[model samples]
Target: MKKQLHLLRQLVQQAVTHSDNTTSIVTDSFAVNQAGDLLMIKDVMIDYLQNLSFSKKPEVFIKRKILHTQRECITLLDMLPRTKMATPDQVALADQMRKCLDELLRHLHQHNCYFSCEVNAPYIEIQRITDKTFQKMTVMKAALKRKKIYSELLNIICAAFDRFHLSQQHTYQHLQYMSALQLSILKLCEKASDLDFDYQLIEHLTYWCFNECHFVDYCKSLIKKALKPHYGTKQCYEQLCHFEKRLTVQQEKANLRYSVQRNSVKYQLMVFVQAELECIEKKQQYHSGGKGVTLKHTAQIGSYRVQTSFSVAALAYFMKLLCESGIIQAEPRSQLLAFIAHHFQTPRIGEQELSASSLATKYKQVTPRTAHAMKAKLKELCQRIDDDFGSGD
Candidate 1:
């Protein structure tokens, strides 16, 4: 029973890692299917162990080892705190671990009922035929075996704890780096007011900021995966306490606000570029003595207006409509609208191109009637914008 339990636990660990890998990418669905299959297999193993018999003397020793292992598992459950943000798959794995522990304990209790009074008198006499010294030595050997079994179990659980701890640290560092890059780009956006700012630098920063957000999302995924199991260990718990102390709830909220500020940074940089172009166009018009020049279309996103001549105004207006329609309920609705508009309406280089289908996969979906209403609203807005601007020609 001890060996079977250890082997089963190892299988579960591997399957969990596999599932995490499968769901990491947005382009694939096969991995998700395979992951589901793997989880089902783990469930079968749990059921098998729950029903396995453990009534004889040697089997009783195995039962004691299982009980000790279950205790250790219970300690691990604290790793997955209710407050932590975990992915759905990670939460399911935690639930599976808890259920397995409970099932083992329940089966052990059932086994106890059979030996409540030891009513087999002939069996008791047969057990006494052995010499007292022999019986003592056999019991001591069983105790040693049980100790060895528990030692192996501890190694497995502790190793898992350490592995996830390192994974969390790595992903956390990546998150910090992404946040820093975002801050630097926003600083550049602010410095554009000086009139001598580097357009090239802003362009590069804009591209980097847009591209690296995907990796930021990937890092978040890794963090959620490791958050639960790593916190089970004393070392990890201490580390988390220190880290959380360093970043209080107020500080986190401040950071989130700062992040939202950075959302407009790219558009603000583009506005600077448009201003430069418009200045050149005005100078050329003055030089040419008042014939005419068709100004390039530029799009605006901030405030409650479309302050540009481009088709991006239509996109921005549609996004406002989407937000007011209650499609996305995130705080700072302006920022959420900007994110959805940027990704859905104007994807930058290296960003995932999202369509309605892909958006449905990630965010909330409306019912058929609401969907039809939203579609009609979008169509009407698009027609009005097109009739007003005539494609910016």
Candidate 2:
């Protein structure tokens, strides 16, 4: 028992050390790489939970370790950036960590139940300990509830808006969309902060908005229509009315489906984890090997498919330029590369077909000499485009 307690203490210390290291790294840098930091914390917490699970130690000892781990996990959760600014990968990782912490608490509760039944102490003494433990657990659970609500709401909003794309030229429309989204989110947050907020209502609304209505596609179409030349206010209002009618029809259909499947264990589980599963699928696609389609083929850009071919390094450089310009926003270089590789075909460099993963790896090894030439080429392209635009006008 002594050895087990000692080992558990060491695991907790290790996790705490990792959490501190992650915090320090974020604090020291403005351009903190949250995905990597969050991943490190998640791995450490999982390791702690695994070690705690395998122990045959006394419930009292296990409870201590669980509480310590839970507290540390909450600290790590608090350290995460606000959901509005956090990348999708970071949000997913934080959600995973939250699940791990919940599992740990569940384990702790099981231990408490066993402890109450098995301990030979006076009945009142056991009752006091159990009640105190429950109280602490309740406090920890409350600390997590607000964060969970924010994360869930953000996830639903993001999913609904993911397909709504606009070019940089449409600055007015872009600002309006962003302002509306921010305002809606702010209101949702205020409501969620209230003590009497109906969390179940949020859950049901998320399901209805995300699954029942063609929400993403709907947003995309709405934006497209609103952006068309000479699209007046009357047309915009009529379009919204049509959308509402369609939404009502879809909601009715959704109600029938929900009534049928809401009680099913498997259906409920699927609905609960749908977002996580989609995130996993996206990651898998990002990391998967190429489809053997070379860059000689056309790639889709907006409504048009244009044929283009560029070497891997040239393409990476172009993507970097796009990020540097305010034309598009992407983070952490790897995501940008993956986006390019996913849309464009695999480019062959020196008799080797460079897949998405390989493309990212090769992009890093690009010498400064090669980068200079790519920069010059990009500048030349920009000049040509400018000349053509001037002539056209």
Best TM-score goes to which candidate? 2
Off by over 4 Å in 1: 1-60, 82-86, 107-393
Score each candidate by Cα lDDT: 0.40, 0.42
91-201 per-residue lDDT for model 1 (tens digits): 554455545544443444454432221111121122222233233434433433443323432243234323322332222222333345434534544443321122223
* Model 1: lDDT of residue 75: 37
TM-score of each: 0.20, 0.25
Worst 10 residues of 1 by lDDT: 116-125
- What TM-score number comes out for model 1? 0.20
Q: Candidate 2 regions off by >4 Å?
A: 1-308, 330-336, 346-353, 362-366, 389-393
lDDT tens per residue, model 2, 17-74:
4444554221213223432343454455556556666778876776676655544433
- Judged by whole-model lDDT over C-alpha atoms, candidate 2 comes out at 0.42
Which candidate ranks first by lDDT, i.e. highest?
2
Clashes per model (N, Cα, C within 3 A): 0, 0
